[model samples]
Target: MKPFLTGHEELIHDIKYDFYGKHLATVSSDQHIKVFDLDSTTSSWILNDSWKAHDSSILRVSWAHPEFSSSKILASCSFDRTVKIWQEQPDELHGSGRRWSKLVTLAIESYAPIYDVVFAPNHLGLKLGCVGSDGIFRIYESVEPSDLSQWALTSEIPILNSSLPAKSLQSSFAIEWCPSKFTTTEKFIVVALDQGFIYGTKPGGGKDDLQNSPRQQSPLQQQLEQQPQSQQESRYIKLGNLPEHNGLIRSVSWAPSMGRNYHLIATACKDGYVRIFKAIETAKGDLKIEILAKLNDHKSEVWRVNWNMTGTILSSAGDDGNLRLWKCNYLNEWKCMSVINTSNRSDNRGIEVEPK
Candidate 1:
């Protein structure tokens, strides 16, 4: 892979590619956001726009679905305790260039430094989800798609199911929505705090086609269905939590199910292990999670784990300064496919600030 310099004054915290994979966006501790477009002829990325987006370190950046507008849309969260939305528009003054304009700032309900922000899947409309040091997860939806500045807070839920012994001053979180195209009954999201938790919504109206699925309830399913009617009628509810994590989870990713009957999730944890969980839906609509693999090859605090588009492979990065690729073979055992060591690289462009 070719690497290019971003020319930021400080370290970058997050980078994301747009839905079409033709553009790239990055947020940096310098509090600036930069956008780049891929040059087809040269097969290289060209910087398209750059602007100061926040008052403090920007932690994450997410691209809205391309179908949302003719021009691209982006969302960013920062340690400044705010999230901002931006849209690309022609430079009115310059008349020959394009620039990104801030559409709105969401800070009213923010209580702590925001750590993560992500856009919901395309089918879910233009919704943004964010989590912060306060351990609260908040969702915002566009009140009117055509009017970018108008947004409404639709839901806010604490991530942890049980109270911690005391307040955590170092808490951070990451979240990802299920990217399944086949499931029409409900939408699901997984959040990582000290542990992983799966939250879901009940079918909103009319009739659910999966209503006829077998009614033999699993223990987990029974507990979820036993929640008070208030929770059952809410926009979203806590469906289940994952196995305990040894240390705070740094990142979590839900693999695209690709129409499979099961779901796959991966987590990067400060305990120096990358764990993969396989979740299967019972006939009664309960989710049963089994540990598919526990990999300690990193031997250092892993910071991120992500699945390929097809969910056939996973790539992890960590403090060890190695990017490792993993895949499952015919025997259904996961093994390291390759490792790219960046620790000894002499290129300044490869250097990154370790996450605090």
Candidate 2:
């Protein structure tokens, strides 16, 4: 932890960490993906582990399965309309000093440019989800789609809930599915608007409109239908309509796993507001978003907000060319834990957007 890890060609769009805490990865708008590791004994020193992962600017990258860390799988999506899966090359690192071999790449064909990617809870190791610029959520089944039978398609979870306040294509920046398919009854998704509106869905998520489709009785539709009546109580339940940032909602990430009774969220807004929203439990249909803390230290629009693999803290980045970490206080509020100011003397994050 030498205050910063060196090496990246350009601005970073998102970061994902393995559950094991030893390996971490980042996707950059520069069209590259870098995987890094921290020294076990000295945690602050960041190692540079990188590969040219995509043809165009990368929009998202996520850990495929850290529950199985050695054979590391990282799924990355980009403006090139491709989703790629990368596994660690064995005996790849030359020395103990922080270098690894090129990634063994496999492409998951996508119809459109993918902006976000996530792995579904593992029933089989192959289930994964991806969302594109068109706001269509497509779940790809094959590790390699050319193997069509093994690479079957899952239903697409369309983003525009015809009934809710939909953010037009010109405004959306990211889509995130809950990490755990925790409940057997429903699914959860967080839609981040470029204009700062963050909307949420509960268990039988988006059932109000997701059930009806041109193809009657799709697998997902059946999943929606078969949910026990009791579980459908808040199906498509609209949580808080949080005003995230002033410019665009760059990114949104749900906390990893915590066996708790409530939900917590962290969002990075264009207005440079790194916000934390806590779910207040109740019997009503409205999901309450209590802004537990507001961070205004950055000088530019914040591009992303992600809770660490463990959910105890969150990391955010922006046009400002800096990375900041925030931690929760005993009062359930968030405060700045650490800050990496700039890669060089030239980068600075600053903006004048009005607060949302």
Candidate 3:
């Protein structure tokens, strides 16, 4: 495949691929969103569309499931405290090229700058999850899937359960949905603020009335429930937390189960460490979390951590300007399989080793 230089004037904040990997969406601090399509003939990327999406620097961009609409749909959040949706439409005026049009803008609840926005798994319907400097986890769902613009705020829950002010400008937040379609009963998303916490939707994901039904609670949730009455109550249930992350979390990614019984999540932190957590559901519906591996190979603040499609291999990047690939062996141990240093332009080859 051939590479083309990006036209973004400022630093790119996020890049995401569509569900089928046919299109790529990138957002930048220049307040623009660019979509690139794969050219099947030349195996190269072609700039499909670009537009000024936000008033301030765009922080994140997410693509909805391909099946959600006949045309491509994208969701973006920015420092302007708004989440905007765009849809690809036939450009009647141009006649040849398709163009993107703003579908809707969501900015009612978020008082602070939005940091991250993610679309839920296709199985969960057309929904978007957002988090920002306000420390609120907001869920918006399109009740009428065919009409993408018709969306309503379904839930607004605090990221932290304690009374301590959750709002902070120094901290960043991220959210990732559970991608397992086999998980039929419970639907949830993991949010990363000071640490990683899993929050599950109630019986009905929409604006359902608060139900005090009996349910099993993890030990951590039980402790959170014992807090003072002044603490704000949330509709979403707290599933569990990724403990021992002493510093602020930069990113969190959930791995595709690929038929695995348990779930795997990777976390990037400001403390110069990368952590992987294994979560399993018990018979009582409580989540049991354990640290699978902790790596400090970056020796600097970790920026991002993501898992491969099959959940077999994991990749991490940090402030050290290096990208590392990690994999687990049959013995249930993880090791760094490869490293690519970006500092030296001449020697850019990746040093790779066998997984086992």
Q: Over the stretch 232-343, how does candidate 3's per-residue lDDT look in tens digits? A: 2344578788899878888888999998899998999999889999999766555799999999999999999999989999999999888999999888889999887656
Worst 10 residues of 2 by lDDT: 208-217
The digit string of per-residue lDDT tens for model 2 on 1-356 reads: 34454366787767667756677787887776777777878676455556677789997777765553446677888878877766565555633333433343323445556767787554334456676656555555443322312333444445654433333444444655555434222234545354323333453444323333212322343454465644543334445555545655666767765775556777777778887777654565445667678787787787778787678888888777778889878886677888776545523442233345
Clashing pairs in 1: none
How does model 3 score by TM-score?
A: 0.85
Query: Which RMSD values do the candidates have, in order?
Result: 7.3, 8.5, 7.2
By summed lDDT, which 10 consecutive residues of candidate 1 come out lowest? 212-221
Candidate 1: where is the Cα deviation over 4 Å?
A: 92-98, 161-169, 190-192, 203-233, 346-356
Q: Give the TM-score of candidate 1.
A: 0.85
Write model 1 residue lDDT over 1-356, tens digit each, in one string.
Answer: 36789988999999999988999998899999998888888888888888888999999999998887888899999989999999898544322234888899985688788888898887666777898777678877676666878886656777765663244445658888888856644445545467777776654431112342112211133443355544433646565676867987888888998768889989898899999998886564457889999999999999999999999999999998889999999999999998776874534555544555
Which scores greater on TM-score, model 1 or model 2? Answer: 1
> Where does the lowest 10-residue lDDT sum fall in candidate 3?
210-219
What clash count does candidate 2 reach?
Answer: 12
